[model samples]
Target: MSNHEGTKGNLLAFLPLIVFVVLFIGSGMLTNDFSTMPLNVAILIASAIALLMNRKETFSKKVDVFTKSAGHPNIILMAVIFILAGAFAGVAKGMGAVESTVNLGLSLLPANLLMVGLFVIGCFISISMGTSMGTIVALAPIGVGIAGQTEIPVALAMATIVGGAMFGDNLSMISDTTIAAVRTQHTKMKDKFKVNFLIVLPAALITLVILGVLTRGNAVELAGDYPYDWVKILPYLGVLVAALAGTHVLVVLVGGTIFAGVIGLLDGSYQMSSLLQATAEGIMTMEDLAIVSILIGGIIGIIQYNGGIDYLLRMITRNIKSKKGAEFGIAGLVSAADIATANNTIAIIITGPLAKSIADEYGVDPRKSASLLDTFAGCWQGILPYGAQLLAAAGLAAISPVSIMLYSFYPVLMGICCVIAILIGYPKFKRTDDASASISK
Candidate 1:
């Protein structure tokens, strides 16, 4: 084949991804409900399609390719981390840790600043616990309660909680999105956090001000006292502190799980058998996501082997001549993936390799690239009506997801902040090559 023909043929490798997006989005739009089309099913069909293409390879050879990629060391390591994180979250929640943490934050709120309090508390809890869903589930009802008692809008309050959740989800060390980003880019979690934090801090502060002004004089009358046990808050605090101190992620997760489980046992909140059960349930919750990660690895492996990635990189970077353009390209790519999938973590997983290639080619810092991937994904996921965070909050508040989406100020501002960062090259940091050369000197 001529070189031109070979390049064109490689472009066809993207066909499976195109088909998956069409089927997933098409079915969701037709049904007006995304739940009917399981993500795994769409991906499975796409995986089969990927295998079916590249006809020159024998069936057995293709299968071998799929299996090897599925079990790639990085993918396996990520899966194991997912399981550990699930176990830790499960055990902590089972011991009433979430409730205690929520209550502790609520107990400190000034009556008139109920809205602001929810946002701040959501940030703290989500950052500590490393799951926006958990934070939303714990805070959304309180937001609803505050709305009922004051002139605050339910949608506004719910949006505040979600905005806060996204803030922490973007920065949290133990978050799966963070894990995927850091692992894929081969950067440290703490390093990524530093980059991500500087980019989003202004947005978070601005959102806080907006929430404060919006809820000013909307004093909430207490219906009941929020009770909390200090002991139940220890695990989350420990985990957060250790993560910030630059401890290895695996050690933080395993130690956090054991600490939470031991506390539960000592407090009579869990029997020994119940601790084991909670651990199992948590691991089970992450099974679907872990499997999806492996599947994506396999599919992407095939596509890359077929030169789809090279073709894609060529097209995307063909006109990019500067580092800022490269950063924007990475941001746009991940944001698009998030929009198509409606899941930030999955979007990061899918876009990570592509983003890494771009970063390496353009001399973009890994930390900056990781930050862009996580921040952009969170920005879109925060406001998507079909996204889990908004949906959960809307359902709990008994309002439309669009209503909450309209008021998700933090996410909107977060995206803008990211853009500004890229435009001006904010939070300047040493790239890997620069650091290595300095050390060698």
Candidate 2:
């Protein structure tokens, strides 16, 4: 009864966010271009609504709440990562690393297996880099080029890259999602990774097979000089090695950018001015996303302060009677958070603490709860046509993010696999720490 009563005001607190999503989606539908809606603008207006709704607090105090949330440490870290990712992508392209790397991959795969190879490479690169955006930035352009060369739908190629990126985002030990999930649930990264990998491996294998079969009828062939420059790829290779060796992503990206810039300069592939310009351009490209991220953070913080999320927690878990219900609740919370923020890492961070509480109450394995949060969040990230993975991939490929939805089977399959994991409790493990509900595979 208390939960039922708590939900009443809480539902109203979240209305502003609902309005924002409606306006954004409505404007897109009116324009027939989903990407036409300025997400930051919608957020700003909704933030204003959130302020108006917070009548209990003084306006000044509400503004303070908004400001603190917007500038939170997690948001700041994400902003920094965005800037470096953009710079690395731009400078590497300026240095011919993209072309060289794509050619290298093409050189290794037959025409019919191009999509399969690209998806596999995306998996490896994302796992190594511990970032889906970084992998997408590095690989989507190549996927686009492959589509152009082979007369395939550009959407299919980009979907392959985006799908594989999500895979690693959920499973990579060094990924921010992994770190956030593990820390929040008080589980080890290896434990989460092991459980996560086992749950999602079949989804990946099926995706590979689907891509291979789809591309098998390709009558078109890869074109161009197919130039090979091992030197240009060294920066990417070095970054991969550093990431897999457990180096921080920011350090790996910054070092990789400088390495690519130097190689470009030494090899006469880029002028000093051109390299700087490329870096600047790359940073500029990420401005929209960066700003949107901050606004979402502020809006979410305000909502939470006003009792929106707590309301959700009570409402969603009011009837959770078993471990399965708890798992779904955990997954649902993060998925909702991801949909609201359009960022999986932020989603996990926002829901993780509450998820931990729920896990403890229901005796759900921490490893499984962490995996559920990561997997569900990762799934939504892929399917959200306006989310970072799709938007970034679309921007790089020069295509519509919506088109990729038709071909993005991997994330959908991944989501299904996670649901199956919840139902069957596959890859079962014994709990190690009775206190924290630690699990051993």
Best by TM-score: 2
- What overall lDDT goes with each candidate model? 0.78, 0.81
Per-residue lDDT of candidate 2, residues 203-315 (tens digit): 99999999988988984665655787999989878877877777777888899899999999999988989999999998787777677667767877787777776666667
TM-score of 1: 0.65
Candidate 1 global CA lDDT score: 0.78
User: Residue 267 of candidate 1: its Cα lDDT?
Assistant: 91
Question: How do the residues 221-244 of candidate 1 rate in per-residue lDDT, one tens digit apiece?
Answer: 556887888899898777767765
Task: Give the clash count for model 1.
Answer: 0
| Candidate 2: C-alpha lDDT | 0.81
Scanning candidate 1 in windows of ten residues, the lowest lDDT window is 432-441
Looking at model 1, residue 383 earns an lDDT score of 91
List candidate 2 stretches off by more than 4 Å.
1-9, 186-188, 222-225, 360-363, 398-400, 428-441
